[model samples]
Target chain A: MEESNWEPKVIGFLCHWCSYAGADLSGSARLEYPHNIRIIRIPCSGRVDPMFILRALQNGVDGVLVSGCHPGDCHYQSGNFHARRKFAVINRLLKYVGIEPERVQFSWVAASEGPKMAQVIGEFVEGVRKVGPNRLFKDEKKDGE
Target chain B: MENRLKEEAGKLLKEGKVDYIVGYGKGTVNLRTSPLITNKEEDLEGLVINPFIANNLSRYPVELKGRVGIVVKGCDSRSLTSLMQDKKVKREDLIIFGVPCEGVVDLKKLAGQIGAEIDRVTDAEKEGENLTLQVDGSKKTIPFRDVIFDKCYGCEHPTPLEYDMLLGSEVAPNLDIEKSLERIKELEGMDAQERWNYWKEQFSKCIRCYGCRNVCPACFCERCFVDVNMPQWVATYATWQDNLTFQLIRTLHVAGRCSDCGECERACPVGIPLRSLQRKMVEEVKDLFGHEVGIDKDAPPVFSHYEATDPDEFMK
Candidate 1:
């Protein structure tokens, strides 16, 4: 638990049509990105409920990233568009409740954007690292044990 | 006003226009009222309209099965409008008896000022800007402004905005949206850590009573996420994290649908300042989506519809 060795635990929810493919492309291209993220493949960004992000944070993830297809490029036509609206409300709500806005990030990564996907992940990990661990939702009793 | 309310209820009952009228009856304790649903003309005598009538009758209509008549204040009417907009209640099934409100008093504040536990409030009367309360055979005069709930101070609708029949003369709304905005701005000025600590301390006091959610008119879901066990969305425990998660989820769920009736805050046993959380979303829905809930029946909810030009400054 030394400060210099500390690495944030991040959860990345990648939509199947675009962000998932972009992540796959990153792996195939062997691009270097932060190893902290644990990816959860979802059908589409619209399927990612705000509860999922909250649950992840409550269970002690340091950060969460929801990556979807570009708004117009959604595989389900307007799924990403709907998700964009939902995420906007959710983001503002989290910030209003005093949670760090940087901890929960949203992005649009196309199926062809391998380098961009890697860069987004790298940047998010670094941002979360600077904020240190998410102590807001951590259970102190469990931590002590 | 009480006689007029009883007369209306009697007429509606005798005419067979409504299955039952939802109104307020004297609570077992003084200075309190309870929801009373009655179909009999004789029961109409129990229907009362006083400054102590704090229960929102709008919540009863949704669970009712036939044509129903209900008495509503300005805030209750807004909640009814939201229910209609959400398709939870049908206008054709409702016969609204609107009452102009001069704001309701917070009994706690009144009791605190008196410096004694009130065994019984024998009589209560409001004249002009003062309320004379006969508590335990002793009369005490308190300014109406001093005893009124905080929600009523800047009440934007003293008269029902939408009603089938008006029971009294309309009163002008005391606009308080600016005051709400100022408080939000003050909170925004605090650093993230300070804000987080503030909420953490506030949420830690929650007892998991769920009174806030139960009393809210907007929380009409058949299966609330917290009750869903197949994939449990939130812990049922009263830990700060669980309480915070439950509150955040509930607030987001009611973002565009909340009428700011202050029922949740009023019902909260812990006095968690629930309205602050709700008003934040209310303010944001207005600023970011250009939408206000329960104002127009035709308009879709703020989140249900979005313009392509909606702000996306946070997205990468």
Candidate 2:
């Protein structure tokens, strides 16, 4: 299919204390992962409001991944815990609207797991590729030409 | 419905008790009764009370301070109760001429049935079992059972729950609350993912007009969390995420206190079923704490007061 031939545009939000550092380590280790993932570092996972994810999708991004500190390991202690409950709500909302749930991913990535980060991104990119582009929002516009 | 309501308004103006009398008048448009605050007695001629008055005129008591008189129906009186709970208005500062509501006509539904825009429907009469609308161009007869608001269906509480000067016969509260109960029960059966998807579709269409918050009589917060920018809780942008955050926060904030007046649903331009969320939250509050809003002023919020016997399963 023509969709598999094109590289997916994936946006990732990484917590500064853990997930962001993990990405940096992955780069230092010369690990190979899909370059489609564009990482944005935030102070904590709690700072990533549901608005960011919706804005990204509305702007034509194919997928979103929010990675934070492992459970109970947040730099602010309960930041990731709050984030977990919030994302659960957002995930439910997105799926209900007929958008494929595979397009949005949420997982924990500790700072030390550089190889694991690379593997996770690779799997996410593959999953997003299989889902193809989001047609729900795109169809809202007219003018086929 | 009473000569005293108009007489008192004239007396209040002549006695200089108030600056204005906020009441209902014949709508300049078709079929609707619009709210009017008149300082003159001649303007009071348009004032008439019947099943057609649907607005919660008690809301103006807070904003139109310094002594005012408002026409109250049963649901409108709840706004008055909520306003007093928040201390937005003082009881002694105003006069309430409460009317016993048999039921208010749902003008939107009535318009659809009659196939004509209701332009100043005056002289509505209950003839046997049907309501006859006296419109400008034509007289349309609609069944009394049809065109009444769903909230008023089998509603025995047609009289104002509370009033200073009663104007009509007292009405009783209809005991049928099964319809609202059934809707919540149906939603509870959906899986988590299915529920999430359902709400996402509903909330994604939000235009973020903030009409729901503005129209809510209980939502009298000086600085709504959505409007605050110091911490920047929810984004100001009109994205689905921001919209969801705004709705969830508003729903949770009014969980135990929402009166389910259906004002938010009526005010929405997009026709979003806001009552679903508000009613859902109210049902949850009732099931969890056995609390119903607008019942007593002294009772604390459901979340604020927790018993030792409370279930701790949701708590990690």
On TM-score, the candidate that comes out on top is 1
> For residues A1-101, could you state the per-residue lDDT of candidate 2 as single tens digits?
26446788899999999989999899999999999999999999889877677657756789998889877788987787766655654554454334577
Query: Scoring each candidate complex against the real one, what DockQ results?
Result: 0.72, 0.07
Interface RMSD of 2: 7.6
Off by over 4 Å in 1: A141-145, B118-120, B176-186
The DockQ value obtained for model 2 is 0.07
The Cα error of candidate 2 at residue B5, in Å, is 1.7
Candidate 1, TM-score of its B chain:
0.94
**What lDDT would each prediction earn against the true structure?**
0.86, 0.72
Model 2 chain A weakest lDDT span, ten residues long: A136-145
TM-score of each: 0.95, 0.65
